[model samples]
Target: MKLLIGNKCYSSWSLRAWLLMRAAGIAFTEELVPLDTPDFKETVFAAAPGSGGTVPVLVDGGIAVWETLAIVEYLHERFPESGIWPRDPAARAHARAAANEMHAGFTALRGACPMNLGKRFGPRDRGPGVARDVERLAALWGQARERFGAGGPFLYGAFCAADAMFAPVVTRLDTYGIAVDPLSRDYMQAVLAHPAFREWLTAALAEPAIVAQDEVDEPALVDLRKS
Candidate 1:
């Protein structure tokens, strides 16, 4: 299987699919197409003909699955023993719901603070929209951890598709210096410290390609990419 993704530094969606597969030990080769390049659309379209020219397209032989959620489902179905989702039926349902909510919601925070792994910003009041989004995120995470995360630090005990879905959100919270409750903070720490996340972050920092839109206007407190 070959997963076609975008730049590690700026592609949050790509990180979702890549992190899930990598953490699950699902062996698959990856191809990175730097975003905003001249032939990005063409390259993605060629690789995933009907994917709406998006990143994180997983191609397994003749089957090409696009969209991060679809990719998660595909992998879960393909490798049931991989434990991509939770083993319990209730936990599995909640995990899927949480992942889908992440997929569709949280545009306010996403717009205010795009996921940039190389820089850290001093937190400030972005806006009411951002504040609301952050509040919701914390509550959502807290709910998951309280209900199903006793087995491990992740949302659903062990790292699963739901954690993969929110992994980039974890980056956004840390990068923008957004504060969360202790539970959420601990969950975020676990995500950031994960081996899969560390591998992705290291590669992201080394990436020279910069997406201008994703780069915020605020001055960065720490620019680790320069260091």
Candidate 2:
């Protein structure tokens, strides 16, 4: 199996898929394709069946799979022992819901706070849409952790598809210095401490390409390092 990803610093979708592959102990070779390059479109088309300039395409047995959530589900189906999703059916349903919501929703927050792994940034002047999204995220995370996260620190005990889905949001909250509740903040810390996440962050810091528009200077990076 092989995974094609974009610049580690800027591509949230890539981060999600890559993190899942690592955390699940799925063995896959990684191919890093820098975004916005002239060959990226052609490269994406050649690599994945339906992807058009999209990052994080997984190639397995000569088959290509795009879409972060779909790739995660594929991994879960292909390697059940990998434990990509929760074991229980009800928990699995809730996880799927969270993953789906993370994949399709949160447009405002996404637009306002693009993930910059190496940088510490302050939150922007959030509009109504962004505010609502943050509130919804807090509620969802808090409720999930309260109900399902009994055995471990992740959303549903062990790190699963839902964690992969929202891994970018965790970065967004930290990078933008968005103040979430204690539950959400603690969850974010847990994500940051994941070994796979730290590995990803190290790679992101090593990238050379710069998306200038993505950089913003506002308040200040609030270090969330656990003391």
Candidate 3:
């Protein structure tokens, strides 16, 4: 299998599927396409004909799956024993609901703070929309951890697809210095400390591309890519 991704520093959606597969120990090769490039659409089309020219396209054999959620579902179906979702019925249902919510909601925070692994900033009041989004996210994470996160630090105890879906949100919060409750903070730390996430971060720091739209107007506390 070949997973096509975008610049690790900026591609939050790409990070979701890539981290899910990598952290799950699913064997696959990766291809990185720098975002905002002239050839990006053409490249994606050639690799995944009907994929709507998106990153995180997973190509296995002759089949191509696009959209982060679609790719995740495909993996869950293909490798049921991989624990892509929780084994417990209730836990799995909760995980799916949270993951789908992440897929469709949280645009306010997402717009206010895009994920930029190469830089960090001091937190400030972004807006009421961002505040509401963060509040909702914290409440959701707390509920999941309280009920299902008994076996590990992740949302569903052990790292599962739900965690993968929120991995980039973890980065977004950390990068922008958004404060969270102790529980959510601990969960974010676990995600950052994951081996696969570390590998991805290292590569991200090494990437030379600077995508303008993904970058924020605020001054960075430090440029990790240079360090």
Off by over 4 Å in 1: none
Query: Can you write out model 3's per-residue Cα lDDT over 1-227, one digit (the tens) per residue?
Result: 99999999999999999999998899999999889999999999999997799898999999999999999999999999998999999999999999999999999999999999999999899999988988999999999999999999999999999999999999999999998989899999999999999999999999988999999999999999888
> Candidate 3: where are CA atoms >4 Å away?
none
Q: Where does the lowest 10-residue lDDT sum fall in candidate 3?
A: 47-56
* Candidate number achieving the greatest lDDT relative to the actual structure: 3
What is each predicted model's overall lDDT from 0 to 1? 0.93, 0.87, 0.95
Q: Write the per-residue lDDT of candidate 2 for residues 28-120, one digit (tens) a residue.
A: 999988887889878888887567669889999888999887898889889998889999898899999999999889999999887877677
Pairs clashing in candidate 3? none
Report how far off residue 135 is in candidate 3 (Å). 0.6
lDDT value, candidate 2, whole model: 0.87
- Order the candidate numbers by lDDT, best to worst: 3, 1, 2
Residue-pair clashes per candidate, as listed? 0, 0, 0
TM-score for every candidate vs. truth?
A: 0.98, 0.93, 0.99
